[model samples]
Target: MTATHHTTVELAKLARVLDRDPGDLAFLATLPPEALREFRDQITDLTARREARRMQRVGAAAKIVPAPIAAKIAEAAFGPVLAAAIAGSVDPARAVAIASALSPVFLADATLTLDPRRAVELIAQVPAPMAAAVARELISRGDYLTMGNLAGSVPDSVLRAALPHASDLDILQVGYYLEETSAADRLLTVVTDRVPGVIRATHNAGEWPKAITLLGLLGPTERSKLANVVAAQDDEVIDGLLTAVEEADAWDTLLPVAAGMNPQSLQRLAQRPAMQNPTLLTKVADLALTQNLWLSLLPLATHLSPTQLHTVAARVATEPDASLTTLIEQAHTENHWPTLLPVALALSTPDRKRLASLPVMHRPEFLTAAIKATATHNLWPAALPLLNNLPTTTHDTLATTINTLTDTEFQAAVQAAVQAAVQAAPAADCTATLIQILLRQDFAPRSRSLTLINEAGNLETLVGTITTRDLALWEGLSDIRTEIPGHLRNLLAAQATRCGRPELADNLTAT
Candidate 1:
């Protein structure tokens, strides 16, 4: 690279290191090549000489005195400045010996002036209280880069003492730059009792995006611990973090932390008002599926508003079978089948049929549990769509489970359908669904069929709407419910006379 370009690059790097702005300097292109070379050479030589002198001073200071005498003389002479030089110059073992001999007050004072690169190597030897006082000094000075450098090498006891000295800004800045993330996590673990203070500090700093990004560095177990901390914050703080993520377009940064949240924390988050936004929920659903976070997310689904629950359920229903299956299994395991029913309802016809036929779904336990959940939660409206879509084999499997339900369970499932139909917002579809489940030949109980036909509004539309193949579906219910045969005989006779198919009408009674 040209001398001018190299100089500009080095200046830019230095600006970044010092956290200073390196503004536009297109003017650098206009400098004469010869002048640029001379300037660059001078700066380079100056930098080299300064570094050489610092090294020479380190050597000179190490040889000047015995460890104890040097510690005392340095204390008396340049005070913090002399101690700073010793901290920087002496070998780590010898520096530790000298630190032990020095007073905590002097060490705390020297820490303020000591270069962090040098201080980090020697911090372990300092007493906890002294280190804490130095940390307070760093926070007061806003010296995050130094804290960042020291973070990994410091012991938990030292960091615990020191952390109280930090502000939220201090925590954020140090967390952002810490060289060893695992060490930073260790520090966080040690000071967990102070997590709320840390959270408050982070919020006060308005560094939510940065804070969440740093949270992503921890392992799942560590993140779970912090998740509880974040959850304990007031609603406004949680809302602000979400708003910050939205404004910054930082969903990627929030994902891992979200994935690691404990179930209770996930529940609290899912129930937040912000989670009601269809757009936000869609984004969450997309990320949850993409990241395979169903294990974390499915439990939260139980807490969502019906509308939000449906929205998420719809998203999962459209996912590939493996993702959908994982979600179903988790919901079932968590006893969240009441929640899963709505998602199942949202699937396309073929997917619904596919789900029903999956061996897991067909398990007698799942089938009975699903039926009980539907009845218990009044979820017939949500489940009707799936029941209607089940293939013949799945129908028989479900029918077997339904038949095993006690009289009360059977009545509850039927009553759930009746109430769902009565209360259905737009009554047309769910009433037909109730009719289908009650009269489907594979699953019908004779008594429930009789009450359903009498109570459900009308069979004319339901029966007339049935396709040619479903005519047999209608005929098959006759033997199960004595009333069904008489009801069908009247309907078919009226249909046949009206359509002028007297031969078909006569055959209806043959069954």
Candidate 2:
């Protein structure tokens, strides 16, 4: 070949690397962005040409052609395009021989991009060194979508035999393959499953949510096994658990999480209970109320009922500081009415007479609790004096407590003007908290239950609670639609569909 032709080929290769249009100086300045990209994709692979050259030389050795004429093919890094094409032909023996001759070229052209399926097919026919080279290239840069399909395509025996000699000296071979397979759960198994490279890929892929879901093999047992991993890493695994929860909410996936004491850890996270809102602190109460120690409920026994009062009272009855009769006596006089009621309610009971006689400031709280527990006239009559004394804070508490009251009490309060009671709270001070609270459907926040988000909040700063509640109620109503009732189960379906969340949209519809 002429020196000019060799120079031109070198220039084309350079142009390909720089992603420029092959030299036509007259038009170079005019190339559009689209034209530049096209030029780059067009020249990215030199494998075909390299393979052809090798085959041509091999063919020459069998022919009368002079060796110098064939020697031209020996310079390229891979088999010439003609050789790969010939090897890729249906003749298996010829394919193997062609690959064996080209193995060295593959090792040299290590960065050559390969077709995933084609590499899987052609690698088997390749000589060992060449197959290793090709496998390394595919593992490093081939399309991830092809990993599982390709792994399963190969007979595991041949693949396993080839694995030890694979170019994957570290774990990324398996990493990239696992990534391609979308099976991250296999990471632990890959680590302990006696597959070195496989585990590395699995470990890396475990960090990504999509891959973990694909793996489908991780369960509660595996999570508990890995609990001793670093906290930061454990957090990452928790994130994976969170995604699994959002996707399936399965029991197996839920139970093993207690190992990590995370902030979001809510116990009994079986399928979201039949009720949308479950009392979270009730579990905390459970841990506290269990019967091992007698004084577990000592600090707050005055608020509990005859049955409940006695049960927890028995636990605290042994307190060295106070006699059981002293505890009962203090509860009788109601010096500690407020604290006692909350404790009583937590225990699912209220000292009925003491709760009824609580200060005007506290009457709404206990009455509201009693109302919710289906208590009757006595609870309502006890709450009446507090009607005018109720502050906006107390009103916020009563919003919830009122919901628990008997319909008769609810009617009396509504007649007493709940609309006005809501208005009395400073619009700014209560607006944000009330909005968030109502969003959660928690109606009561008595003087005792409220934290008073801002104490210095002025009258101007006080948000009228009614307006905020109305806005939240409307917003939720929009989401909790029932336009098509009966068999048409979901009203949110139409909205979800318009937003491209068909899965959520479908949940809004009936079968």
Candidate 3:
């Protein structure tokens, strides 16, 4: 349940125990549910104990009268509250007989005042048909608290008969007010096929917080089933569900269910048009950071359009460094780099730099995992920008890992870098960074690496990077001059002269 709804449920129960309107006890809503429940239980126990002697006397008298007469006297003289108070003290069989004789309306009235804990045996013995009748009466009166209080104590046979008379909305409301999670679970089991209708009813009624609370009360299997039912709804209903969760700030309850859904259902939910709302996406991103829900969230995020994914990336960029570090570590641990790398690529240059500069990004294991994920997912196109921004401290580790890539992997990285350079503006920092890292490493197949760079036809940007960032890179090219095809050597030498680096140009042409 959302925290607000949980507190409201507790306050209502507490109000009933103290005989106060729920509004009068609104001040207690800030207290935790457990605290409120404890206070309610103490008051209920004290009240029942204090009234035990008088109620016992009444019970003894009711036994002497015949059941039919006792029912009349209790309704006419004692009233529902007094009648309920004496019920626990009566013999279980005698109580059942008396209840059977009373009209359903009167029985329903007494149920409102009855404490199920005190009358468990009597409630259990009531005939299923009679229980169903009282349930119908309570449903008509919208007395869910009374129905919820007694729902679990009655046998499953009673629920089976009684629940069909209640609409989906009625079931949801009663589930909300149910005092026991086990009761809610039992109720869900009896009405498992009604989940889709209940979800639609909840959406139509704007009762998502109640539905989310109900989801939390079920076991994993039931929760997944109900979540998929919600997922299967059309965009309008699904959007309504998201809006309600946002309004209630109830993502904590909804996210786990979203995470646990079967793959097809999860993808359907992820691709909904409502999932692209920037405001909602921002909130969910923040929640994921705080709750360590990235493992759950990333899979869903992968299904968003490029535009929508960038919205999420922009939000993630605003998080602090420590938060970014946690996200990176989680991505590595969960092997979610394939999912996260795209978001990193989508970040603005400055934000990408911030992500790359995280301390965790410098760790050998994290860098290795990132490289492996890039190779495995064939994600080098997206990985290049972030890799380009990584701190120089990590270059050796990155270079070591990159050099270990198989022939196919190495060529893919080279092709991706060349493509990034060709596609980027003149600065081409991504390709430049890759070249710089390669130049620094004891890269094997040096001839093959240099050959790929020469053949890729992006020498102007690479040469400019060499001149501005590290002129010594020209000597590395000089050493591998044989790998440079003659025409490409002329192209690089001419571009170098154009940049007024004639001496460096001499290195490419001389050998």
For candidate 3, give the lDDT: 0.80
C-alpha lDDT values of all predictions: 0.64, 0.36, 0.80
Worst 10 residues of 3 by lDDT: 460-469
- What's the distance in Å from true for residue 149, model 3? 3.0
lDDT digits (tens) for residues 87-141 of candidate 3: 9999999998988889999888888778888988887788889988999999999
Worst 10 residues of 2 by lDDT: 267-276
What's every prediction's RMSD, in angstroms? 9.6, 24.7, 5.3
| Global fold similarity of model 3 (TM-score) | 0.74
- Residue pairs of candidate 1 with colliding backbone atoms: none
Backbone clash numbers for all candidates listed: 0, 33, 0
> Which candidate model has the greater TM-score, 1 or 3?
3
**Number of the top candidate by lDDT?**
3
Model 1, 270-379: lDDT tens per residue?
A: 77788889988887778778866565555566666668876886677677777666777777887878767766665556666787667677666777788778767767
Better model by lDDT: candidate 2 vs candidate 3: 3
What are the models' TM-scores?
0.61, 0.28, 0.74
